[model samples]
Target: MQYKSQAVAKPYFIAAIGLFVGQILFGLILGAQYVLGDFLFPAIPFNVARMVHTNLLIVWLLFGFMGGAYFMIPEEAETELFSPKLALLMFWIFLVAGAATIVGYLAVPYATLAELTGNDLLETMGREFLEQPLPTKIGIVVVALVFLFNITMTVLKGKKTAIATVLLIGLWGLAVFFLFSFYNPVNVVLDKFFWWWTVHLWVEGVWELILGSFLAFVLIKTTGVDREVIEKWLYVIVTLTLITGLIGMGHHYFWIGTPEYWQWWGSIFSALEPIPFFAMTVFAFNMVNRRRREHPNRAAVLWALGVGVMAFLGAGVWGFLHTLAPVNYYTHGSQITAAHGHMSFYGAYAMLVMMMISYAMPILNGKAANSNKSQVVEMWAFWLMTIAMVFITLFLTAAGILQVWLQRVSDSPLPFMVVQEKIAIFYWAREISGVFFLIGLILYITSFFIGGDKKETA
Candidate 1:
């Protein structure tokens, strides 16, 4: 089956690039606001910056997933995408909708956006059905469904390989599960309960499947590791991820006034959640070490290896530090949680996606590999961003621990505002470290436009 589609990878690549830039800018804004307090308002408020930060992370990761799918599906299925034109169309529509939604978030206050989108209307009336989280939730559902349909149909028509098929099914599950959050029950407890259906399930659940498959795809292509070896690791990683993560959702319910049983359930399962990430780290490095062929794209290899190590530190180590109910009793909603979230997402997911893009760029552009010079620059960017983020996480973790001790554990607990004042230095340090991250992003964006040397020359 000869599969030919105009490289669908390019658009998704561009989208990923745009979102990466947006994320860095938003991160800087968020960091500055933390230190400067009254910085970049009206033009870019703190809340707005935060919204952009979170939303851009999700969007760009999705873009990476989509692009990776486009690149991998044809090879795995042994056939072209079912509808290349439809895939292209969905790309544009999603981009436009995502941009409009971001604008809506910035242009109007949260309350106003809710009202403008009829979320408050439904809430005010007896219906209570359309609340603030509803319209945005609906938009996400639509986008997820569209993406699922495109990917599923393509897979259905093509050859079925373990890696590609797992990703396809995983993404389909991700889309379907996200829709459950829209019809949140009337009970506040239940609303919070179901909210994790989308948030926890996607990130910690099916998205792990997506990430595992993506990592395996890249490793297999770049390292020329035995297919059997790589696929086995992928299977083991996903199996462990699912076993621990599904039950780990109970962690969120710990302080939400849910049943007491969740104390044990959440803590135990969440504590065990790091095992798979540890396994992933081993998998990536072992494959690279056992590679049968050498690739000139050392930057991509470095990023892949970094993803593993960082995932261990960010997701495994830092996450377990607070997963226990005893520790979380004080650290909930503190900067410690923020620290873990930032590094884990960037290290495990974002780095993996970036590695995929870097690996795919050569294949998509019909080049054997990127130039040593550009690869070196990108590798530097990776190290810079990775190191800066590590510093940010550590500082925030310290600050969070301080806040928790001062507010929750002190002899005479300080007021929250007073605690903020106490931690002001840490915030300043975080902002300064974020400057390094921004610099790394600038280097990364610049590398894309400035073409790399040919593989033969390199």
Candidate 2:
């Protein structure tokens, strides 16, 4: 809101929230399908729904990240965006490409969609998360390149700050790592080995840098903390993130036909992965305690704090739970993985984006903070969605524990389906939790429309 070009981020944020709603709705469908195998049946099979759910998550988060960058970069650099027009152009292009891809997923069969989109040319289809068609993949690269160019140029044209520098690194790394998706080697082991370059390295690696930058930016604004102190903390957090996360990639390599040495390396490094997150928790609270001013965007402040605690719990604690080779051997690809994934993603990236929106949206709409009435609603949405996710993770963790016991650790191992039947109760509980998440999402969307007297942070 400080720069005219920053107005462009409003659309990105709006579109992000829109797509987020779609993601959760599909998530509900997926959850129900788990409990009722024939819930959607031929119309929308579980696999298709699952793909939509996960893909939507990636796309929406990308939108949120882009929006956050557009909003924050200019202020950090003390300049307007290099090309607001180009930013808006790429926004439409990315949105269309994302929509078309989702339509293809829902309308045609996966194989048919792949064939139509020229999967035979490069054959990057059907990977777990990298399932976008060739053209969509290409479109992504184009959009990302253009977006990065704009932001980089903007930073170059103005004052450079630590927050902007780290953010750019994270964003550029995101683009660079995504190129691996196009590699798609024929060797299964090699393919998976490189696939983690895109998948695991993203959430656990570069994305953490992006998360830290945003956290620092918000803390500076909301807490009125000294930039020097926050930047120092940012440096420490980033260093820890890279040291821990880069080596932590070995955790995924453990079962991926990698070497035996990975067992010790992965165990040691992944165990230390929680240190950075712990630092983030301390950093958030410490800044708040030393705050020079209380921003009227109390909702945004609450979100900032939530990100620290939840990220520590989800990514730090739960991740360390099954991260070790011995524990992962039993829990790999189990519901426990799902549990960890759900919480870590929501607690870290998702909440970070939401915090950005909560902070920026009010400013974009011409206010220092939302009216107290609206902030109350937004805060309620936050807790409801967050707590709902916690329950979902807990229930899934319960299911995963039972599953590992019955299928792997038991004296008489049961078949997968039998184990699933035994765990159906937990699935039911998770599905119900998904409903609450949806309700919370609805409330979150509703917060945007609720307006009253504007409150000034000053």
Instruction: Report the lDDT tens digits of candidate 1 across residue range 267-323.
Output: 999899999999999999999999988987788888889988998899889999999
Alpha-carbon shift of residue 89 in model 1 (angstroms): 0.6
388-440 in candidate 2: lDDT tens per residue?
99999999999999999999999999999999999999999999999999899
What local distance difference test score does each model get?
Answer: 0.81, 0.94
Error of 2 at 445 (Å): 1.2
Residue 403 C-alpha lDDT in model 2: 98
Ten-residue stretch with the least lDDT total in model 2: 449-458
Best by TM-score: 2
Q: How accurate is candidate 1 locally (lDDT)?
A: 0.81
What TM-score, over all chains together, does every model reach?
0.94, 0.98
Task: For candidate 2, give the lDDT of residue 121.
Answer: 86
Question: Candidate 1 regions off by >4 Å?
Answer: 1-3, 120-136, 451-458
